[model samples]
Target: MKNKPAFATMEALAAVLIIGFLIVIFILFIHPPKQFADARNVRRTSNVGTILTALNQYIIDNGAGPPGVDGIWRVLGTADSGCNINCAKKIPTGIEAAGCLDLTPYLVPKYLLNIPSDPKLGKPEITYYAVRQTINGRIEVLSCGLESNQ
Candidate 1:
């Protein structure tokens, strides 16, 4: 009898390669990379922490926390509106102002050079929030988009 071919035919090799390519595609679709997501979370946490620290410093220097547009003491605002008072108002300067909470105290040559925006900012959703709780009279900064539980 004639000896069988020791190696696969060209057609069989092509078929195997095609199958491998398809499998790779499927795997990529099923499990996307988490690096981008993790990076965004890290940046968000850093931004939040920076703002919180600046707020504390502002309080120490001014002898009072920056005033909220609604009131000195306010509940935490939603991500959509930022802080409770003037959620839509643009902060021209960081100093205390009416119709909005001014973070200028933290921005102008003091704490932060500029206000750090959320990674998903301008997406028609709130990503960050702040409020001064009445019970303890402390400023609370929050990042709604933070990935980690703590």
Candidate 2:
């Protein structure tokens, strides 16, 4: 009788451990943290597209580039905190190493209701978004704060 009780306890413990392991596997593989990361990436892609479209429309309407668009990556957002003009240092990669483009005056109310920010670290001072015009007049806008190894 004593041996039977011990065996039952061991079996119970093993079953619990297996259930725990399966739950962990379900959380890790079946349902992953990557879902949130994927959502953020989607927002970033949408933001980039919105910014690009706004810039293109601005160019079409005005027949010229918005301010501070000299073929360099300009951080998009309001300028502040002693980094009045070029806030490239704010970006992690610091692609252009130049100014922060304040498109609020130009884009807001006309091209866009308001400038879009990064899904994670967006702010008015430095939106974590970047824009630049290529030499061929192609405009590029991207989210500088891409997440999940992106």
Candidate 3:
């Protein structure tokens, strides 16, 4: 009878409501697949680490590491674009005197392919904070953890 049609309508409405609820849940719990900056921060830190190692090596071999402005820019294959031209023979202005010293100058190496810029913050604006220390008489570079706040 008429009741049957009413029940059918209610069923459809209920189904629609359920679908809407699920959609809300999906939006709340299921994030769109995207590479967030937090995920890319690891790579940035690793690149920083690599640069630190290279600088340490440079110091060990030359009796002095690259200039300590922000730190040292990586000079790829002796290109002299980053630290080579700027700091190899002389020092460059890097960082506010109190800010994290720029490290891009000492990262250059004959085998290093290129300067690994931060993927999240992009080049020249490296948001990662760093600190230099001598651990057990060895130069150690420390960086802010996942949040880059160090």
Q: Which candidate ranks first by TM-score, i.e. highest?
A: 2
Off by over 4 Å in 1: 1-33, 69-100, 122-127, 147-150
From the highest lDDT down, the ranking of the candidates is 2, 1, 3
Please identify which of the two predictions, 1 or 3, would achieve the higher lDDT against the true structure: 1
- What TM-scores do the predictions have? 0.55, 0.75, 0.48
Candidate 2 residue-wise lDDT at 3: 50
Question: Tens-digit lDDT track for model 1 on 1-150?
Answer: 888776669878998999999999877875444556678778877877887788788878888866552234322222323333333332222213222234554445688776566675412223344434355666666554544333
Q: Give a tens-digit lDDT track for model 3, residues 15-108.
A: 9999999999887776433335556656767876875667667777777655552233222222223222212121234322333344444553
Worst 10 residues of 2 by lDDT: 80-89
lDDT of 1 at 93: 28
The TM-score measured for candidate 1 stands at 0.55
Give the range of the ten consecutive residues with the poorest summed lDDT in model 1.
Answer: 90-99
- lDDT per residue for candidate 2 within 39-141, as digits (tens), equals 9889989988998988899999999889787687777766644222333334444655444679899899887888887767787778878778889999988
